[model samples]
Target: MFAARPYEDVLMDDIAQQAGVSRALLYRHFPSKHALFAAVYQQAADRLLAETKLDPTDSLVGQLVQGMDIHLDYFVANRHAVLAANRVLAGDPVIQTIMTGELDALRARLLAVLPLADESARRTVSAVLKSWLVFVQILVVDWLTEQTCSRTELRDICVGAVLGALRPLLPADLVPNWPQLAAGRAGA
Candidate 1:
């Protein structure tokens, strides 16, 4: 129900009917609509994170591309839910916490796979990634609404942005080859 309709337009009774459960049971589990949305959003986040595998065998670029693709797929599918979380529930603490947790988990996964110079470099790169992820959220959310560019272009833009931001910070030898970056995404 949350995925198919705008947050404001969805009613508790409708959700109960859709679930084939009594309104009393629905309210028992999730006291309110906001609570239900939060739970659903968290479940979606968990699924996305699980699907985006950060394998050590793959190139960093490949993992990045895969992660972005999985997320973009979800964002495109659940457009309304995302808008509600990012716009309508933007100020809500629970929703914000869920977003923060997902970002932190992703950052941790990237850090695990990233070729950092040392602990100092890891710290710096972590901070940079934090900023980059937040930028991605804001930009992608806006893109969902306005759609100023193609999805492929938007994906490339995000991939390019992070690579650009990390280029100067990363050691030369540690950096992935840029020329062939886009040509072979899965192997890159």
Candidate 2:
């Protein structure tokens, strides 16, 4: 309903009617519309993370590809929901805190997988990976709305960009196979 209607017009009564529940019941669960929106946003984020199931045993590049695929798939599937969430969360401090915390957790998990030689290197690699991921996400959103390229083609572009950006930070052996794996993804 949030996606279908303007946020200001999506009242508790609208949600209650849509859900076939009483307004009182809905309010009992979510004190305000903002709370309900936040809940939905958090649920979507959690669902996206759960669907990815990043494997620790996989190579870093492989894991990154899988993660990006999952992220792109989610955005493609739930573009409106994502847009609604973003709209509702814009300029909201509580939502911003929640998003930041979730991202920090994701960063910690990714940092665990990267083989950094020292604390400084680990921090540098983590920052680079975080920035790369954000860039890829923006690209994915643009691709989702534009549909200028097929998912396979977009995946190849993303993989290439990610691998190129990480070449200096990643192991030498891993860097060489990045392009090969990306190119061969259609076959696999």
Candidate 3:
């Protein structure tokens, strides 16, 4: 139902019938449609997070570039679910809380791998990391709507944005060889 119609148009009865379950059974598991939607959103979000995880062997730059591709691919494949999740995100406090938690987890993961010299630089990088996460989401949504650039172009731009934003805060020794590390890449 969600695939064919907007989230608001999906009725509990339709879901129950499609799932070969009674409405009472469905309600027993998910008290409301909003709850059921949130559960699905959680699964999608988890998949996104899983895909975005950094490979332990990759450099910081490599991780960033890889994550950009993973993020964009997920958006491209799950556009409808992403749209519905975004709507639920705006109107539902429970979903909002779950997203906040996911953001915090992402932040923690970035901080763990990001190379900064001191607590002060780490704090600054942390802020930049969070802001860049939000920027990626906004840029992808806009790109999906406008088709202003190809996916490769979008990935290049996003990776460049993240590296450029963090360059000043990162230690000189920690900086990767941009031209060599991500050579022939659109953003590199």
Strongest candidate by lDDT: 1
Between prediction 2 and prediction 3, which has the larger TM-score? Answer: 3
Model 3 TM-score, 2 decimals: 0.85
- Candidate 2 per-residue C-alpha lDDT over 44-115 given as tens digits, one digit per residue, 9 for 90 to 100: 777776776667688766776787778777776676655555554557886766666666666777888767
Over the stretch 104-185, how does candidate 3's per-residue lDDT look in tens digits? 7777888898756789988888899889888887787778768899887788777778777877777755565554544555
lDDT of each: 0.89, 0.74, 0.76
lDDT of 2 at 42: 83
Per-candidate TM-scores read 0.93, 0.82, 0.85
Clashes of 2: 0
Tens digits of per-residue lDDT for model 1, 69-173: 899999999999999999999999999999999999999999998777789989999999999999999999999999999897788788888888888888765
Give me the runs in candidate 2 sitting further than 4 Å from their true place.
2-11
Error of 3 at 87 (Å): 3.7
Best candidate (score: TM-score): 1
Q: How close is candidate 1 to the true structure, as a TM-score?
A: 0.93
Give candidate 2's error at residue 107 in angstroms.
1.9
Which candidate, 1 or 2, has the higher lDDT?
A: 1
